[model samples]
Target: MELQRLRDVFRTALDLPADAPVDDLHYQDHEKWDSLAHMSLIAALEDEFDVMIDTEDVINMSSFGEATRILGKYGVDFNG
Candidate 1:
């Protein structure tokens, strides 16, 4: 459930197809993932999950898969 919501965040931010594979989506893979999009993504995620991510985690969240892990640190349980 949470992962799907996370996917929705990615989908909306990147303008990606709903069926787009998340795991393979990375920093260099999409042209839309520029600095502006990165900040938008961070804002969307923070608003969605109600968590404040610091700079390091924001920098480290370079991919969709990594997003799951970083969000885990904030107690957003995708597995549940």
Candidate 2:
């Protein structure tokens, strides 16, 4: 559901493999998750989830798990 969609967005934005484990990924830690990729990831997330992310939240989104928590603030439910 929403979690899978978020994973898909991460995969597409970061150009990751379909089976890549995103839960533990951190910005600038992953080879592909650079600054440019971070912006792409943010845009993809906003588009996919239909929410406008704040600048502070964008800066705070340093990890995949953190992204999930931030999205939760925007009404995205990870728990079914």
Q: Give residue 12's lDDT in candidate 1 (0 to 100).
A: 87
- How much is 10 displaced in model 1, in angstroms? 0.3
Q: Candidate 2 regions off by >4 Å?
A: none
Counted clashes in each candidate structure: 0, 0
Those runs of model 1 whose alpha carbons end farther than 4 Å from true positions after fitting are: none
> Mind sharing the TM-score for model 2?
0.97
State the C-alpha lDDT per candidate: 0.90, 0.96
Which model scores highest in TM-score? 2
Positional deviation of residue 67's Cα in model 1 after best superposition, in angstroms: 0.4
Query: In candidate 1, where is summed lDDT lowest over 10 consecutive residues?
Result: 20-29
| Residue-wise C-alpha lDDT for candidate 2, range 5-48, written one tens digit per residue | 99999999999999999989999998999999999999999999
